[model samples]
Target: MRVVLAEDLFLLRDGLTRTLREHGYEVVASVDNGPSLLRALLEEKPDVAVVDVRLPPSYTDEGLQAALEARRRRPGLPILVLSQYVDQLYANELLAGGDGAVGYLLKDRVTNTEQFVDAVGRVAAGGTVMDPQVITKLLSRSQARGMIDSLTPRELDVLEMMAEGRSNVAIAATLHFSESAVAKHTASIFAKLRIAPSTDDNRRVLAVLAYLKR
Candidate 1:
């Protein structure tokens, strides 16, 4: 798959480019700033983009804003954003559209090449992937909102894996439950979250992000 990468750190950017290339992803463009990232996104039209939350110029949410704008211009453009720490606001904004081809991960995750590559592939295939750390923090914050408190413990477990972009079969295997049981729990999650079936949106992504809304 073709990729556009944006990271301010030269060493990390080079390392990630090498990692993705070793895993058979074509690095179409590698940039270090938000404007360059935006240009690359529009010009390269890569299959996926790996962006750092902070980029040059403002060194704030520049990379993220570029990614979001690119998605605005080219809807469903798969993007996996990396941050030094858990930034719930950035994660929420990325998922706010309820599109599935997106991910939010910590930069530290890059050391685990296997998992990082898997996340890239998943996002490229129009799946949502959240860093485990991000998921845990979001879940913790949900207690204040109580949006997910109604869910059973088991259902909450299933929901966590779902947020990590695991398939029903994968979740079932990990949880040692039948696939049918996982399906049932998934359905219940949607119901309890009040996520109505809609042809225009991805309900699974919506369900995974429901707790963040309220």
Candidate 2:
């Protein structure tokens, strides 16, 4: 897969490039700062971007913001954000649009090269891959009243897999249910979450996620 990477650290950036290359990824443009990252994104139009949450100049959320902006410029631009820290707010922001092909993983995830590579591949294939830690934070931080409070535990499980960009068959297998049963649960989830009925799993995932963000 073609990729654009943004990490300010020289060693980590170099290491990431090496790792991705070893895994058969084409690193189209690996940049070290927000501006350069954005420029490379536009110029390279890579299939996916692996960006650190913090980057040059401000040493804050430049990379995350740039990733968001990149998605805006080119809708559904696959992105996999990495960070030394877990910030629920940033995670929510990164996932706001509910566009497919996105991920939020901690830098530690890279230690398992195979898993990390799998995440990259999944996101490139229009799948969502939020870090488990991020998912826990989102669930804990967003369990407010109204819609969220209404979902059953089983519904929540299906919704979580939906957030993971799992297809109905996968979710059914995971939940030990028939695909029709999974569809019923999804319909219930849409009703409870106030998500409008839709055939598009991407939109359904986004709608469920929008509620989770609340």
Candidate 3:
């Protein structure tokens, strides 16, 4: 798979590039600044983009803005955002489109390189992936709205794992529940979230969106 990377730090950028390349992903373009990142996304049209939330030339959300703009121009272009902090505002904006093929992960918490590469692969395959820390913060913010208050604690737990792009079987294994039980929880979550049945949208992604937007 082809990838475009944007990170200002040379060491981390080099390490990430080497890792992805070792894992068989072609680093089509590696950029340090927002403008170059934007140009690479528009011109290279790589299969996936691994971008940082901040970049040079006014390093406050420049990389994020560039990624969002690229997605605006090319909808469904997969992007995996790597950030040192969990900015709820940035996370909300990234998930606001409610589209799959997006991820938000904390750089410091990623101890396993394989895990990071797996997340990139999942996002490229049109899946949503959220760091555990990001999910926790988003859940905390959703509580104030009382929107997800209706969900049982177990349901909330199930939803959190779902937001992390786990399958029903995987969630079952993680939670020590049967697949049928997980499916039941999922169905209940959909109903409580008022996520109506729709063929066009992924209920799992929409469920996460409902909570994050609330």
**All candidates' lDDT scores?**
0.83, 0.82, 0.84
Clashes of each: 0, 0, 0
Error (Å) of candidate 1 at residue 97 is 2.0
- Residue 146's C-alpha lDDT in candidate 2? 57
Which residues of candidate 3, in runs, are more than 4 Å off?
136-144, 197-202, 211-214
RMSD of 3: 2.5
User: Model 2: per-residue lDDT, tens digit, 1-214?
Assistant: 7999999989989988999999999999989999889899988999999998888889888888888888889998999987887667777877877667888887875567887888899889887887656676777757555576688988878877877666899889989989999999989988777678677666666666777677
Question: lDDT: which candidate is best?
Answer: 3
Q: What lDDT tens digits, residue by residue, belong to model 3 across residues 39-67?
A: 99999999999999889999788888899
Residue 64 lDDT in candidate 1: 91
What's model 3's lDDT at 196? 55
Decoy 1 TM-score against native: 0.85
Q: Each model's TM-score?
A: 0.85, 0.77, 0.88
Window of ten residues with lowest summed lDDT in model 1 = 196-205
